[model samples]
Target: MQRVRTAPRHIAFETRPAGKPLDAEWTQITTREFADQVSAFAKGLIASGVRAGDTVMIMAPTQYLWAVVDHAALFAGAVVVPVYDTASPAQLQAIIADARPVLAFTGTAVHGERLAQAATASGTEAPQLRLLDPDPAIPNDASLAGLAELGTTVTDAQLEERRLAATLDDVATIVYTSGTTGDPKGALITHRNLVGQVLNTAAAYSEVVQETGNTVLFLPLTHVLGRALQLICIANGMRVAHLSDPKEVVQSLAILRPTFLVVVPRVLEKIEDAAANSAREKKVLPLWRAAHRAAVAWGVHLEAMDRDPGARAPLGLRLRHALFDRVFYGKLRAVMGGRIDYLLSGAATLRPELARFFRGIGVPVIEGYGLTETTAPLTGGRPGSLVAGSVGTPLPGNAVRIADSGEVLAKGVGVFAGYRNPVHTEQAFVDGYFRTGDLGSLAPDGTLTLRGRLKHVIVTSTGRTVSPESWEQTVEQHPLVAHAALVGTDRPYLTALVVIDTEAATAWFRDRGDAPARALTEDGLVVCADGRLTEEISAAIHRANAAVSPSERVQAWEAVVIGEDRASEFVTPTMKLKRQALLDEAASITDGLYR
Candidate 1:
């Protein structure tokens, strides 16, 4: 509202039409235009009998209208529930039953049908359905245009009556957790929660936030961090755009030439992989490899100097870095639109080496940490304080304390009100601090370095404890090693169930005019029997093993190839590995290793 009043004509968003070419001109949506859309939609929602505290479901991709409906629903004194476009039927049914929205909105006819089916499957009354993007063929319920027609019956006074009834403490959204371990629980994010994050981020990164540079958001809007970052962008007067499909992100980054990006570790992995593949195809693989090494070296040098004031980068290292900056780093930056200064990563732990690699190439990857209960961001990397392995220092008002049980605890303005379920809420907090379930240690400088999840800590037969995440992340740095899960609970030695990335492995062989040897495991899954592939994987494991004790190192491992469906069962949509699920279901794969 303040933006509309102050700078009504300012461009708030830019979007390219679907099916448009990459070079096509983007359509601009201004602040006043967006604000008006919100007001009219809120009136329509009110006219359609939506009341204060009613849950309004918006199931769709990240786009302009998602922003409109989200704001409109909240403005009408209703709570908004964002559902990811890729949600499965089972997942849909579970959320629909729990949220019990009074009105549901979908961007496509297919999603509308899915919602209707899920509502039926859950045995819940179907909410009044509405289409976000109008389609003449879709039957049932009002479209956005049709909603405007209904708004004629609603008066300005009536809309204001419900809107004014909202309070800061009221639940704005019930964001469901990714549910890697168990059922998804709704974390109660209040209006205050969102505002608090925005304020703190703006304070911490004033120049980074307030700059007039544009950014493209590709993460799912259903993600709490995605939604919160959008708000922070608006608060800081940055022009924003959306790309619903993450696969198209590289092109969007080049097209938008964004000043910064917010993404998870997987996205960075993809970006690096894409660059490496392009280099391989162009026959510049060796040069690219050298550039990568130089960049990483520079990053390590920078971090050492930052930590120790008396330390300085050697002249030889600095000169070589400068050469790589011109010869290779510039082109790498061009792929990222040539203007990105910051790469804000969150949602999962980022590998330390990847952070160093990017930071060395003039793009500092600022890893941050938070959960749905923190409303997305509680800590973020600050300039001059970035530590490669640490997520960052706590934000302006948010602070974390380590519990005796190795859990990260927090209490702050951005802390969520509580969980939606009373039973879960009772177990969620201790002495006013929200239990973060993650285990971490804080650097002397206040930056936080996450070890792994508390529940994932491995206890071996000899009573030796191991943190499998660091090992898994390091081994996964190999493009061929898609996923790694360390196993050795109550066993003599640690073994692993490593999932081979068949696509990448096959491509590598094909590019080299060779083929991978193949065989079937006892459990019937395909295994790449090529010695080269095995050697490559063994080399990666060796690197990871070097960082661990003899007992914690993976002595033997089994390789199995998995497709998307099988992989989905073991990982959340965000690519977070479900350790227990993998160990339980794939127990047979590694059984032969122990014998």
Candidate 2:
């Protein structure tokens, strides 16, 4: 309503029609149009026996329909629940058993079926199921059009009464955490938590959420940060386009040419890797390497300058950077729409070099830090202070501190009321601050530099404690290395299960333009046992080792050529390594090296 009042004609959202070209012009939805639709859907919800405080589960990808349903649920004064589209039937069942919503809506037949099965197994009556995108295959109460038809019976006064009855203190959503190291727990996020966070974040980082600025949302709405950002776009009336599929990111960017974009570290890594692999294929590896060095150098210089006013780049470095910007950087920018100013990254740490390279290319990454309990961001990059390695300072009205045990503690408006399970909620907080379970240090200015997850710390048989983050992140930055999971708990020393970047590795090997490369598919991911690629892996390990003491250095590692299996058993849907699963196999692979 406020968005409509301020910007009646402003395009609040954009969406591409299904089966359309990725670069096609988006279908814009104005503020008034979106509000009218949401109101109609809310009337339908109320007419269908939904009352205030009732839960509505949304299990779908990031799409326009998902946004409409989310707002509509809020308009009806119901508590919304989000489930990732990647969820298996079992995971879906677990959350359904926990949340026990009154209705559920999904974008596809597969998720609809999964939710149906989950609800059946939840041991309670199944919720009223609806489809956002109409599916004849899966039976449902109604589709979007059918819901609008249902709303014609409900009066405007009824919808208003329901919407106004809800309060900020009421539980607005039950957000389940991504189970990286443990089981997903339902965190009860109140309206205050959600609205307070977006308002404060917008005030603190107005540059990112400006009215004229726009961005594409590719991350799943199941994540707290994704939902928070969606709300921010609505509250600020920022133009937003939805891209459900990650594969179409390039085309979407080329078409939208947004001012800033939201991203995770993995996205940044893949972008740089794609460029490098393209260079290798074109026989311009040497030129690309020189340009890459210049970009990283330039980024490092800028970061130094950001921290200290007097810091400056050398004359030679400046000359090299300018030359490379014209010769190489411009082309790279062209691939990503040529208008990106900043990338907002969260959920994981970005390696220093990777972060610097992007900044060098003129798109600085603004890394933020928080969890589901924090309602997305506890700390984020301010406009003027961009810490290259840190997760910026706390947002307005939020505070972060390190406990005696090195765990990060947070207390703020963004912090959720509590977890759905009271016992879990009790364990999550200390005296007043929520136990973040992340180990981080705060500078005098309040910038937070994280070490690693407190639970991720590894202990060797020799009684030495090692945080695997630095080693894993350093190794992962290598062009050929996709992911590295360090394992050494109660063992003699550390070793890693390294995932070789098959696509990048194949391009690297095929640059010879020889018969071997032509027959590479039959060869099944050849790693060149004694060639430059092997040497490079060794060099990456060496670099990783240099960052740690003798005991903490990864002594040896086994390369796992992962392909087709995007998220194999060793990795979660979020791309986090299932450490316990790796630890189970670590002994089998590392017995020879340690023995």
| Candidate with the greatest lDDT versus the true structure | 1
Error of 2 at 12 (Å): 0.8
- State each model's C-alpha RMSD to the native: 2.6, 3.1
Q: Give the lDDT of residue 116 in candidate 2.
A: 79
TM-score of 2: 0.93
TM match of model 1 to true structure: 0.94
Please report, as a residue range, the 10-residue window in candidate 1 with the lowest summed lDDT. Answer: 519-528
Tens-digit lDDT track for model 1 on 37-99?
A: 888889999989999999999999888788889988988999998887667788889999999
Per-candidate clash tally:
0, 0
Q: List clashing residue pairs in candidate 1.
A: none
Encode model 2's per-residue lDDT on 1-595: one tens digit a residue: 7888988889989988776888666799999999999999999898788889999999888898888999999999999999887775667888989888888888766677778788888786688777877554543355777777788998888898888897889899998877666577999999899889988999998877888888888888888888899999899977888888877887678789888888888788889888887887788989899989999898888877877879989999999889989888898898888888788888888877787888898888898998889999899877557777889999998999999999999999999999878999899999899999899998988889998989889899999898888889988988788778888888888887776766767766666553332322433222234345566688889988998888788877766653353344456544566666555544566565576
